[model samples]
Target chain A: MDEFSFINSIKQSTYKQSTLLKGVGDDAAVFRQSSKDIVTAVDTFVEGIHFSRKTMDPFHIGNRALAANISDMAAMGASPVFYLVSIVIPSHWTEDELSQIYRGMQSLAKQYKIDLIGGDTVSGNELTISITVIGYAACGKARYRSTAVEGDIVFVTGTLGDSIAGYHILMNPGQFINKNYYYRRHQMPDPRVAFALELEDLQRVALNDISDGIANEAAEIAEASGVSITINYQQIPTSDSFSQFTVNQQRNWPLFGGEDFELLGAVPKRDWPLVQQAAQRTQTMVTEIGYVDIGKELVYLQEENGRKPLNKKGYTHFKQVKL
Target chain B: MDEFSFINSIKQSTYKQSTLLKGVGDDAAVFRQSSKDIVTAVDTFVEGIHFSRKTMDPFHIGNRALAANISDMAAMGASPVFYLVSIVIPSHWTEDELSQIYRGMQSLAKQYKIDLIGGDTVSGNELTISITVIGYAACGKARYRSTAVEGDIVFVTGTLGDSIAGYHILMNPGQFINKNYYYRRHQMPDPRVAFALELEDLQRVALNDISDGIANEAAEIAEASGVSITINYQQIPTSDSFSQFTVNQQRNWPLFGGEDFELLGAVPKRDWPLVQQAAQRTQTMVTEIGYVDIGKELVYLQEENGRKPLNKKGYTHFKQVKL
Candidate 1:
């Protein structure tokens, strides 16, 4: 199909929100903000770097790409309203494959009520999908990563290591039992948008998405907030499938395995009760994994022996380099 | 360099606007809108497709990518405020080369007062830069392509064939005279933002960016507005370099060669004087190229002999296909 026809096909089934003043076919998408502030993020997923044809279906690739951007908005406690996708497809791909990608995106868009505003589609040698998510937050309500106080308690929503374990299962198919569960987690991550909004209502001090694993993201909160973070090894939440792994794998995966798309945040120590109560009300499985302290270390792993420096071994795009 | 460290390096030199509540190192960038509505657009430039390393410098590649998206915003008469860039770089590129790309983007961002907010960086086999621009437009003031009236006069800003001529110069170096002019025009076609705003102030009926050449964009205006358009071939603006070409080259290139980044709009015939006066005040050279009429033909071209159907042969991504 030509560019215009492809755009028309995508436009025919789009769910337009009332806030959208103009959508597809315009030079630009115009929308109104009902709130005081707008939160925006862009994420690009390359075929081989972020996913592969051998392991991931095109539908899951599209789903994960949008989910990653949505997760970023979720960390800000914003309600996602609109998204623009720029996709470069390989020439070899079929029209059905392209439609599957859009269908995957529509599924998530329907759940979040996001309008697919406008984008560009091009043919290239590699498949690359970039999504920009625009969301809204009320005045002074959006969470930040640099607001954690020294005495704040650090918490993470949902279990970590499942995505990484799922990835392992996907790559080494028959080597693991119950591969479906882990593989699903790797392919489809549920962004904690509603849970993060609940935390925002409860007035969390700092927030970030764990796209780069718990240890790296926790260190980011500490570094940005100018505080020290200490994560108790025993307190780290792991999935039931994750528990089937050996001790070393369990310890390393949850701490360093990335792409979890979960929310990691800090709340004042005094407000722990309220935070827990809100999580309980929302049915969000949040675990208190660490605390902030007045020190220089970005993150310290508290084990049975002693507190040691946490290894910054999570995924960074550039190999053998630390951010 | 790792993704985080590269982001930190970029964050250090970024120009943050006062309206930006949060920027790099956050889950999402937060900004405030002084206007009632927001305009957004996304465009991706892929290696070997939109540009090639053999013909264009990396800096020009970056600049052109951002300019393309900015032109979309200019078409809406929106003030470009912020942009998020998601870039996929090959492993072979050096830090200097990557920095040059960022520098190219910074030059345009500085000119437009757009803040570099937040985005993701990843590794890929090919270089792909996708930019999402967010701009503001006053409530009910943004122009739409679907609002042209039957008796509206169509105008285009600056010249149309310059970009395509420049592309030819770049691709076939020694074959063209005044190569610098054409090459620069191709690499950096100035988006008519200020001019479009002036036209918008003058209450222009409809507007669009001429990224896909005069014929296709004019057809878009016609189709979107449900009106017939007639073009006077003599009235179409051509750059000095473009005029130096043969009559056939001039005709075919301007009509069908894409990537002009000029503003195409419709104004009621009665408001022509106001539009001309506004354009003069803004020092923008705009030419009346056509008229919207009460018929079903999307576009008709007037030559010396008689009127003929204008072919929709502008650049579309897929080969040998029409929308």
Candidate 2:
């Protein structure tokens, strides 16, 4: 079928939802909710820039892209209602392969109960995915980073650096012989959507997803909240493979890798017990990695030595791959 | 400065807006609007895919991408409030060039009264610009395209086929020796922002942006509405040069050329007078290109012949570039 016919077929499949006043075939999709609308987030994932075609398959790429934005919605302690997705795939990709990408997206949308209300598809030189997720909350309770006061406990959901190991295995299979851990991390990232929603009324101080590793994200919250962060190295969560590859694996990979897709959140010192209880209720493991301090810096509180300053460089697009 | 520092500097410069509970630095930017909230639109302009690196500057490309999404908000009669722009530029690109691109975006954002809330910068193979424009409307009266009836008259805002002509000249300068209309149309086609806002409360039956040419866009609306449409050849508006290029341009180029970015709307017959008056008041001309018919086909009504069915092929990313 022609592009128009293909688009038409897709449009016909869209089921009407109560919140969505309009869907595809309009300038913007309209929504008709009764209460105060709250938080929204947009994230774009480009093939070569965000993920390598050599390292990631179309399905994982699609899932990760959608997951990245969904994680953002989760971070805000809002229930994701609807989303718009725009895909720009290079002409070289087959329609069947593209359909698989959509299949992956459909899986996540179904899982999260977030309706895929509208989107755009176009041909381009490289594959690019952009998704905007709209989530609703009560008037003023959406979570943010700036609310992290000094003495707030820093917490993270899920293990980090798995994606980093996964990337290494995906990109340089020969160099890193074993494929299991790295591949798993690269393929599937569990966005802490359930945990985020559960903590909606728990008075969590600040929240953010760990897209660009824990250390970089820590620095971000520190800067935004104008508070210092001192991360206790022993408290940082690590997988078995991550621990095994200690010297060669770059222990800081979890602190700097860009595609972990985990959630890093902060809770007031007084509410740490409540935060811990919420994590158990959501059936997700939580790690207390650090604490907010008075000075505006990110410091690594090493077990052997005293505290030291940290750099802001994360997984850089250019440094990882040379043109 | 490094990429992190640059981003931090930009973040530091941002003034806190009370409407935004959280801006940047977190998993997502949170907004706390009074009555209603909506996640808006995002458009990506990648080098070589959306524009020729040789012809279009990064600045214009950035501005245009933002404008495209802003135009979508206007189509829904929503005021653009915030935007997140993620840019991926090659390592070779200077910081000055990057700043210039942001300068273009900043100027337009300021003019539109939109805060450049947050975005990410990364190194990549080619320049990529993606912008998500967040906007809001007062819940009830946002326009949509699924409401068009059989008796509605179709109207289009601004001119068409200019981008195709502009592309022709830009790609092959020798072909179009004279510059005036060709260059301006190629560089910048004004998005009808004000006109769309004026369309509020009109119960605009169906609406779409004419990014793709009118023929293709009309077909989309008709196919979506399950109605037929016929365009009067004499009533179609074109600039002097558009008419001049008819001999050189084929039916495909005029009908299928995308990037017009005008608004194509279907209005009830009774609202036609009001629409025309609104257009006149705004000092912009509105052309009644066609009317909704009973069957499901796009027939171009020609004076010489009773009716000629037109092909619905518009600009396709996969299609071979003609120029």
Quick one: best lDDT, which candidate? 1
**DockQ, in order, for the candidates?**
0.55, 0.34
- Binned by DockQ into CAPRI classes (incorrect, acceptable, medium, high), candidate 1 is medium
Highest DockQ against the true fold, candidate = 1
Backbone clashes, each candidate: 2, 1
Question: What TM-scores do the predictions have?
Answer: 0.95, 0.87
**C-alpha-based local distance difference test score of model 2:** 0.70
lDDT by residue for model 1 (A146-195), tens: 88988889898889998888887777766676788787888988998887
- List candidate 2 stretches off by more than 4 Å: A4-17, A33-37, A53-55, A167-182, A240-243, A247-250, A315-323, B8-19, B33-39, B138-140, B169-182, B240-256, B316-323
| After superposition, candidate 1 runs with Cα above 4 Å error | A1-5, A12-16, A175-178, A315-323, B1-5, B12-16, B175-177, B315-323
Q: Specify the poorest-scoring 10-residue window by lDDT in model 1 chain B.
A: B314-323
**lDDT string, candidate 2, B165-193, tens digits:** 77877777675545667666666666676
